[model samples]
Target: MAKAAVLVASFLFVALTMFCEEATADYEGCCVSYSKYQLPFIRIKGYSIQTPNDYCDIPAVVFHTIKGRHICANPKDTWVEIRIQQLMNKVKKMA
Candidate 1:
């Protein structure tokens, strides 16, 4: 009976952990990225054009979606790294 209880508890723990992991955001915050050439082309469905450019680092955000499928790229050409850092800071403060 004790072994069965332990097994059930372990199973419940594992299931709850997995559920929470799935509920969490894929990219909750922003980070400085030097190159975005390798990232898959994600369509910005709901997000507006905050900053537009054709280069490595870009500034963009997910207006609504939380999963990887909704996050989009901004493609800022000049001063991308700096701008992204600033945006990340602002987001941190707001959060």
Candidate 2:
């Protein structure tokens, strides 16, 4: 019975992995992981907060780079907070 249960669990894991891979391919904008390196402000053009939604599972700060790359960042990181504050200040000045 134990071996049977293990086999079922293993099968389920493989099935879920396949399903997630297809889902990730279908929806290209979700950030499953964050970049480990810190990006400089000069390279960043803008940023957006990614809230958890259907299909997409994690919360992140998505930074748009000057080279047009989407960088997934950890929102809890200090540098992310500083960048957010800087963007907010710029918006406030514009308004």
Candidate 3:
């Protein structure tokens, strides 16, 4: 009986680990942007969100363009998350 219980517990542990891993979708250094009332806001990774007028460093990600140009705007503030790899590449290119 003790051996059976141990086997069941091990099986459950392995199943749970696999399930969790499968549920996660991996994106590197990406941020989700949204609009409100024709205003734009962004959230940057590793830093607090700020107004569009305030300058902050963030990794590059493709976003929707207006009139074929990119314009950062503020509606209520933005949320951005940048990954370490993307940020590192930007620095390397700058150097």
Candidate 4:
């Protein structure tokens, strides 16, 4: 009985680990093209700048819109940089 329980536990651990890895892999290199009109709201919930990493080398600015969508924009884009600054300023004020 103890051996059976250990085997079950090991199987569950491996299964969970594999599941989590696959879920994270889905987000790897997941930058979507930027389109101003497609987004439903202008308000940004959050933003993040992802630098060059092992998986993806290109820098990207990810915008989290109020409608719970992740819009990835080019960091070099003038409009994107401007928007980032604006959002940072808003956060500073709130802090």
Candidate 5:
């Protein structure tokens, strides 16, 4: 009986550990997709490209707007890529 209880406890510990690890995985908080129409209203404050890691499957570009909005855009989109490059250039010049 004692051996069976120990085995069950060990199994439960392993299962809980795995569950916690998955639950605690990092995720991008700004996962909203933005439309081109909204771009005109938003002033780009900064941007960052999130490369795929263990937690995320695809890459994403996060835009920080002056109006305090963090927008996540699909990096695969041609327009998003171009806009990111342009914003980066503008930031570089400002620095």
Candidate 6:
């Protein structure tokens, strides 16, 4: 009887842990630092702005390259600002 109870408890614990992990699977990826070098406009496919939040504390711009790589950049950088503007303009035109 005791052995059966222990077995059930172990199963429940493992199941609950797996369920919790799946729940947070959609968690956003964050950048710890920014890239120093600038990439050309033609190479960038898209970008996302990162701001201080409960999970992410650093402010950055994550630039998505055509080659399926993410490049973290300082939002204050001149080239990054220009790239952001370009992306915004493209979206506006699409609407």
- Model 3, 36-93: lDDT tens digits are 2221322222222232222333323333333332323232333323233444566689
Q: How far out, in Å, is residue 48 in model 4?
A: 0.9
In each prediction, how many residue pairs overlap at the backbone (N, C-alpha, C within less than 3 A)?
A: 0, 0, 10, 0, 0, 0
Tens-digit per-residue lDDT, 1-95, candidate 4: 99999999999999997764311112654553444432222567877766766765556677787866567777777777778777788889999
Q: Model 5 clash tally?
A: 0
The lDDT-based order of candidates, best leading, equals 2, 6, 4, 5, 1, 3
Q: Choose 5 or 6, whichever is better by TM-score.
A: 6
For model 6, residues 17-84, the per-residue Cα lDDT tens digits are 77643111023667777775787888889987778788777787888889877778888889989998
Residue 7 shift from truth in candidate 6, angstroms? 52
lDDT agreement with native, every candidate: 0.42, 0.78, 0.37, 0.64, 0.63, 0.77
For every candidate, C-alpha RMSD to the true structure in Å: 12.8, 11.2, 14.4, 9.4, 12.5, 11.2
Tens digits of per-residue lDDT for model 5, 3-89: 999999999999997764311113444343333333432477777776665666556677778876666667777867777778778
Report how far residue 50 has shifted in candidate 4, in Å: 1.6
Per-residue error at 44 for model 4, in Å?
A: 1.3
Error of 6 at 88 (Å): 2.6
Q: Which is better, 4 or 5, measured by lDDT?
A: 4
lDDT of 6 at 90: 85
Report the Cα lDDT for candidate 1: 0.42
Candidate 3 segments exceeding 4 Å error: 22-95
lDDT of 1 by residue, 1-95 (tens): 99999999999999997764421113333322323332322321233333424442345542323243433344454433444455567668989
Segments in model 5 whose C-alpha atoms lie over 4 Å from true places: 1-38
- Candidate 1 regions exceeding 4 Å error are 22-95
Task: Name the candidate that leads on TM-score.
Answer: 2
Candidate 3 clash pair list: 29-83, 40-73, 40-74, 41-78, 42-78, 42-79, 43-78, 43-79, 43-80, 44-80
